[model samples]
Target: MEDSPRSQELLSLEAIYPDAELDITSYSGTITISIHSADPVGISFAAVPNTQPLYDSINYLPPLKFFFQLPETYPDTPPTVALLSLWLPEATLTALHASLLLIWDDFRDMVVFLMVDHLQEQAFVLFGLDPPIALTEVQFEFFVSYNREQLQEEFDTQSFTCEICQQYKKGKSCLRIELCRHIFCKACLLEYFSTCITAGDIEKVHCPDYECTKRVAEERKRMADPKTFITSGTSTRDMILRVVFTPPLSLDFLSFLPPEIVTRFQTLFTRDQYEFFKSNFPNRAVNCPVEACGHGIIRDDVNDDLVVCPKCRYAFCIHCTNSWHGKSMCRLAVRLDIPEDVLEQYLSYPELSKDRRDLEDYYGKFKLRRAADAWHMDVLFKEMMANELMTACPSCGVVSAKMDGCNKMTCHLCKTPFCYLCGEFLDRARPYDHFNDPVSECYRRLFEGMLGTEEELMRPIAPGFAL
Candidate 1:
């Protein structure tokens, strides 16, 4: 039988795409491309998520199955295109069809191979998979955009080589830090975290950005205070990708770790939370220093300066933060002396050195020593501050000295506004209301007789909104 033009065109297509299997029915034929092909033109996932792109991977992308129906006027008109990826929103399929049509219209004749290559190369991008531009009126457009995000989830399930340990791993077995998005396999991360936790490097549990790690020596030499150093002079933010304290994995994923590891992690995490509370709420729970006593004594009253460790039966004074001296004065409190190593580490300038004897000689003669009872006086001062007057900012340790402004006060250095009485951060909006209520800890004490007038201090928060 003499071949129809459509059949002849189908034969040409089959010749070009040998793997494309054709289902030749009386009405139409469908050619399926069920394998990977080079599509440098196509965009992958829309917004690169908090995960690395599966690198040097080609074995796992799903196949592209499509249908093409020929018109009676074979070489004179374009074939009708239909995609069969059912999970794709209809608008995506429709948008794809429209894109193909544009290519078909450009030729308007015998463009089968051209159309197929376009489909292979551009289908991923044209499928409405980019971050959606909002189009609210048309529900189909909105859904197509909403559903496009699912493509990332599908892409994540594939396997990729973890940069650390240089091993291929399934996506599920890898953890990606949010801001940095560095991929670390399960075994490598668990091992590293185990070693760090065992050594009590709790606060240092962070993304192992090597630049920051390598610069630790230099960072040390440049700063005196390691704990308070915010911006590194040498290692800029980009070198670290993200300089933050958030762990790569959430508490929900803690089950992936062994129970022993979990316990160790919880020990450090609990200590951090306790320290946070202690700094902000000094009289709430006092940490006892006796080794293995392992308990916090609750301070029910603001005036309670003496803490008796319930477990160890060791008594300590809150003001001096030391062993109790009943009638004898508590010794003076000295500023915490930062060690040289810690200073160098904070400065990121490990090579720096100072002439200690020269500095000692210079400072020693200029400064006259006060009475040895200075710490004793500080103890009494602390007792009054904790019991009657103020709280300190947890971040900067700035003491509350509000005389007149609203109960909410912002730390000048850290800019963290906290309550003078509770030392808790005030809601940025309705700060004044915190003291107005009768049940509040600092109630009716908004005006500490320093700055604001009676009306400003007593101004009530408006309904539904805070200023």
Candidate 2:
């Protein structure tokens, strides 16, 4: 067979046995191999010695780190084996090398046949020696059993209790940090993770134990296993929401929440909260008792100043719904209520259905089918609409609208096509239109410019780029 990438890698290495055969395969994201050869002078022979004592030592090793290195050729080169985080005594190495010379003639080509089965186990048996001494048959069996048991322990660390609620079962408690020798009950860590998620503080969810130096690493492991969560009892969803909203969350801190949390929160609070906020927090201020325009209160035309509304030119308190132009503490909560006609006006049943379909599709793909419920969809849609209020196309000055069965849209005034959410013009013909459109360019220039250096533009649009 033609040499594979792994074979090539082995051939390039100077330590590999000359003329040794090489085979490569992968398991659980880790690569390993089986190599066969007959030469004791070969690289494989030098790497692994097949004495009885060596087998006893290898059979006693933990399975997590067992791996075999194979040669691309045979007899001429020796293969290497690696057992991560494992070490052997120098005397053992010396004795194995000496033993190889004595058996060099009988075992030269036959060494490859020794590795004809259980490559990982072979590696564990050969690579994890600590100066092997002779062992009785019962002792040899005990060491083999130990290797098997070690692999089981590694697997148990991954298996947890209730994945949704982050709970651990009674017998399944095995929280291990690879970096630290410290171990914890899986149940404790699950509870800790839930607390972090609910508080909108996943960024801060390190190991609960203050002395654990491997907190960051442990947290990353926990996050990667999506199936690890608490499933039974009261859904912790509401508690998580309370942590996000009850305190006025900064934009920076809120970004850490999984997209699911944000989606759910949006669905739950959008309709009533959005309408109330719009009425009270309009670009124009709340109603003021100013003599010139009692009905108008300018909102945020000028930064940090309570100014007159453009339409009515009435000065009002920026804080409360009062006409106190200079006095402070008049700021009022943005009034928000779902309009009676809002159900029909903003979103039709058909649009909701499409949203539901999208959510279902997303959850199914991600294996989060339990979260793809109607109530969750409802909350997500409402939140989306709430966030998109006052979005308008800067180029055409056209207010954007979203309807089902349509993603492409054209403005009447400027003929600019853009996303409904951000009002950036999307040129329909180009492949990059979705991302590199005019609307996106404008937004980038405005916000990113302020945060970046002098060289940046809003959208980085080239002169010849499509509109």
lDDT of each candidate versus the true structure: 0.56, 0.41
Per-residue CA lDDT of candidate 1, range 335-394, in tens? 322234432333343323343322222122111112213344665568757564556786
Q: Report the number of the highest-lDDT candidate.
A: 1
What would the TM-score be for candidate 1 when compared with the true structure? 0.36
lDDT of 2 by residue, 366-414 (tens): 1122222333465655665465533456675656544322334567677
TM-score of each model, in listed order: 0.36, 0.19
TM value for model 2? 0.19
Clashes of 2: 58
Which residue runs does candidate 2 get wrong by more than 4 Å? 2-86, 101-104, 115-153, 156-158, 162-467
Model 2's alpha-carbon lDDT is 0.41
